[model samples]
Target: MFKKVLVANRGEIACRIMKSCQQLNVRTVAVYSTADKDAKFVKMADEAYCVGPAKAQESYLNREGILMAAVISHADAVHPGYGFLAEDALFARMCSQCGLTWLGPQADLISLMGDKAAARKFAASRGIAIIPGTFVLNDPDATERAALKIGFPLLIKASQGGGGKGIRIVTSPDDLNSQLKIAKQETSSAFGSTSIYLERVLKHARHIEVQIIGDQNGRILVLGDRDCTMQVRRQKIIEESPATFITDAQRRELIVTVHRLLDGVNYQGLGTVEFLFSDDRFYFLEMNTRLQVEHGVTETTTGLDIVMLQLQLASNESRLSRQIPSCDGVAIECRINLTAPTNNNQLSTFSFPEGIRVDTGYQSGDNVPSYYDALLVKVIVNGKNRLEAVTLMQKALANIKIDGVSTNLHDLQKILASSWYKKGVFAVETLDMRLEKHESFTG
Candidate 1:
């Protein structure tokens, strides 16, 4: 076990990782920007260091600053919590070269799975069901050819895309030319890579992802599945464990498929395999080579500490013969974002609800700046069943009150009370349609 670890990220996830490290008797070093001088994670950590200015380029995303912090702190390991440099292969390699343990997958796996096009091809070669897609297209003519082969309503997605960025949907040939150009430009700007591919967009598909943990010993355990279909603006707002739509048999099949895919690749550490469930079949979307933002649901349902497991795996500990953890109940998480209706600005105050688990990295009097992600807190609930979980989430959202900043709390409450969500009949576009219809209704 590592004696001290530096967290190379910010916000709730950084605080969450610090708490887990504390529980495991590990000292934590938090790296923060000048903007987050008094952030929750910094206060929680045993030691905190100011990396750079508020801009991400000079701060959170600055790899050299983070590495220097870890080195100066003499930390044994560095945990990149979810975003920033979490899945950066170069960061992973740097950690290895610096003789510090990277509490995630090896650089090789990160490099391999980070590329969507390469990942799709690897999955196909390993017999994993992959969505119909084309390889990376450098020329617009090749993109047109691939789009025609994949048919209309295809998604022009970035080869190295994540977080729903660098993706565009083309409904027909007329929209293809312009949409492809825009997608390529966005991909280049966001990821610094113009490499893009095509994939058949599954209309009304349920976004289901399997959480799996692997160790250096090649042991892989599928924790379960999460239903992330309740999304608005291509961002998942609510996520639940043990999808309401998939049957027990189907769930088992999905687990087996994930195991097969991992076994073929000899995958390691905590990773998420996302899939598009449509027409009673699962098509691989892409693999996230790091911990997911919605991993709290899985922890609530299974009572497992994923961060501890990741640390152990990074230390080259054996994990073979360990049985899959059992999930006692259903868990749901609502991402409370500090976003306004018309304009995006910093939040001045925040008020939360009681009798619910509110995992947050911000507090009252803290500024929810517009320079970073709008996520303020993650409210998680667990119940004996899905309905009970839904009701608990609704109550939690109702009690949450944040002044001086507009949030999706009211919208989330409406979603929980809707017929589609009540019956668990939701797709990716479900929230958008609901919001469009209820644009005037605040509650």
Candidate 2:
């Protein structure tokens, strides 16, 4: 166990990580910006430091400042709670060189799997099914020829972009060139990379991901599978465990396939291998090499402490005999975020329902800084089965009360009540296509 750990993030995830560390008696250090000087996570930390100003590039994403905070606080390890340098290979390597443990997989693995282009090619070479896609586009004529073969209604994607930034859905050949340019610009501005690729859209695909963890002692655990089909613009809005959409045999096949996929990579720590499932088959998507926002859903279903697992693995604890805890029930998570700007950014009266798990970064009277993500709350519910979970979620959602900001609560309730969502008939594009008419989505 680590004596002290520095959390390299802010808000809900930062708070969440600290809680787990405290449970293990590990002292936690929080690094914040001036904007978050009075934030909840900062107050909860045993020690806190201000990294920089409110801007993420200067604050949360400041690798040097965060490292300095860890050194000054005498933290034995650093935990990057999901975003903001969590997957940055250079940052992870730097931590190791400084003799501080990095609570993640090896930096080389992160680099190899983080790039979408290289990951896709790697999956294909492993005999894993991949969506029809091209490598990094170069010469214009060759790129056009490749696009024509893959057909229109394809996606122009930034090879290094995530969180739905550098992506364009080209519906026809005429729009391909313009969409490509836009995607390139977005990716370059966001990721410092203009490298892009193309993939044919599988019309009615579902977003499915498998959670895996490996230990230093050559042990592995397949937590379970999750269905993230309910998404708005490629960002997952709802996530549930034990993906009910797939049949029993298909579920077994999925587990076996993913297990084999990570068989000999000498992987350690947590990871998620995503895929696009359609027409009784699945194609490999990208892998998230860090803890995800929706990880609690899987945790609830399996009754396992994923964060604690990460800590134990990082310390090379060989006695961890846990192996794939049986999935006990169906669990669903609704991420409530602000859809539009509001008058007062501070929470006037933020409250959540009882008898359910509500993980949040803000309490009543906490001011939400405008600099970071607008995700205010994560409502997670677990029940004996999917229907029971859905029923419990609806009631829990109804009990939530937020008086300050404009959020997606109404939309989330509508989604839970929708017949398509209830019946698990909704595909990846189903929510986006439905909301395209009425709701304006923000990235």
Candidate 3:
């Protein structure tokens, strides 16, 4: 096991990773920016280093600054919880070159799968079913030809994008050029790439994902399947284990498909294979090469500490079999976030209810910064079944309270009690998709 680990990110995930390290008796090194010098996660670390100033480019995302901190701290390994440089293959290589263990898959896999276009091609080459999409195109003639082939009602997505950025939905050729121009600008500014790809968009698709890992034993571990259909602006806000609407056969197939896709890769960390399920078929999206923000839902349902498992697997400490742990119950997680920039960012009345696990980085009297992700906490609950879990989630949301900042409390409640939610038939667009207009998904 690693003696010391340096967390390369900040906010709630930093706290989440540090807590897990402490549980393993591994010392933690926290690298913080000037803006987060006094954050809750900073105080939780055994040693803290100020990387740079407030801006992310100068601090959190500064590759050189983070590497320097790890070397100076004499840490054996670097754990990028999520976001920021978590999936950057170059940064992972830098850690290895510096003689620091990177708690993730090898850099080659990250580089190959990080590019959406390359991932699609790789999946197709492996005999996996991928969504009908074209390669990254920047030429005018090639772009027009690909659009005609893929047909209308498609999405123009960034080749190197995640977290729902640099995407444009188009339904007609007339709107293609306009949306394409917009997507390129966004992608260039956000990802330093001007390339974009087109793929067919399934309407009212359920966002189902399988947690998988290519263990050190050259075997695959399928943790479970999760439904992240409840989302806004392509960002998932609610996730649940044992997807409510899929059949038993479909679930089994999903697990097998991902396992087969990852088999013989010699990978040694956690990853998620995402799919858009509709029309009784699954369309591959992209693979996430790092820990997901919603990993808590699977942890609560499966009785496994994923972070611990990640550490163990990375350090060759856990030699596992192919069997997955049976689900303890139905688990649900709701992400609580600051709805918008509040007049007063300082938290005043911060409190959560009992009977649920709340993972957070803030306590009462903490200042909520607008520079980073707005996520405040992840409220997770598990019950004997789906009905019980839903009831518990509703109660937990109602009992929670906060002040001096606005949150999506009302929005979460509205979605939780909607008729679509009770029926377990909600889709990725159900939150914003007007039920009265979309007769197919209406109560």
Candidate 4:
């Protein structure tokens, strides 16, 4: 076990990692930017270091600064909580060279899975079912040809980075070029990698992902599945575990597929294999090489501390191989944003409601800046079943309050109370329709 671990990120995830470190008796070192000088994670850690200015390029994303902090703090391992340098293969390699454990996958695994184009080829080679798509194109003519081959209503996605930042859906041929340009620009700006690929977009598909944890000894455990179908503009708003959409048979098949893929690649540490389920069939999407933002839902349902698992796995320990964690109950998570309802302006003051698992890294006096993600907190609830879990989450969201920021509280309340969502007959466009109806009614 590592004596000290350095968390190379900020906000809620950093705080989340710190909690696990505390329980494991591992000292934590938090690296923060000047903007986060008084952040909650910094206060919670045994020691803190200022990395750089508020801009992510000079701060949270600065590899040298973070490595220096880890060295100065004498941390034996670095746990990149998600986003930022979490999926950066170069950072993982640097940690290897520095003799510090990267509390995630090996650098080669990161490099292979991080690239959407490469991942598609790899999955296909291993006989994993993947959505029909084209290779990465740099020329405009080639891109148009590829788009036509994939047919209409396809998606253009970035080869690097997730979180739905650089994805565009084209309904027809006329819209392909414009969407491609926008996707490329966004991908380059967000991930510094403009490499893009195409995929056949399935209408009315449920976004299902299987969580897996592996150790150095090549033992892998599939925790369970999550249904992240409730999304707004490609961003997940609500996530639930043991995906209500899949049956026992389908769940078993999906788990087998995931296990085969992980075993084929000899994948290590914690990762997620995402799939788009339509017509009762699962099509492989890209894999996330690090912990997901919505991982709380799975943890609540499975009663597992994923952070500790990552730490143990990184240290080449395989204690969890003897028994797999079972799903005890249903769990749901609602991501509370820091934007206002009117202008979607960022908030400065914040407060959370009681009677729920409120995992947040921001305090009342902290400023919800536009420089980072808008997520303020993740509200998670566990129940004996799906309906009870939904009910508990509804009440939790209603009781929650945040001052000085506009959130989707009302929107979330409406979603939870809607007939479509209640009956689990919702698609990706469900939230769009709800928001449109709300706007029309308000107008």
- Tell me, by TM-score, which candidate is best: 2
lDDT per residue (tens digit) for residues 161-229 in model 4: 556667888999999888888888898887788899888888788899999987776678898899999
Clashes of 4: 2
Estimated TM-score for each candidate? 0.95, 0.96, 0.96, 0.93
Off by over 4 Å in 4: 138-142, 185-194, 340-350, 436-443
Q: What is the C-alpha RMSD of each candidate to the true structure, in Å?
A: 2.2, 2.3, 2.1, 2.6
Stretches off by above 4 angstroms in model 1 are: 316-321, 341-349, 436-443
Number of clashes recorded per candidate: 0, 0, 0, 2
The ten-residue window of minimal lDDT in model 2 covers 434-443
lDDT of 1: 0.85
TM-score computed on alpha carbons, candidate 1: 0.95
Per-residue lDDT of model 2, residues 237-279, tens digit only: 8999989888989888887778767778877788888999989
Q: Please, what are the lDDT tens digits per residue for candidate 1 over residues 239-356?
A: 9997878988888889888877888456777899999999999998889988889999999988888888787676755454467688878999999887663343445657776677
Give the whole-model CA lDDT for all candidates, comma-separated.
0.85, 0.87, 0.87, 0.84
Better of 1 and 2 by lDDT: 2
Candidate 2, residue 118: Cα displacement in angstroms equals 0.4
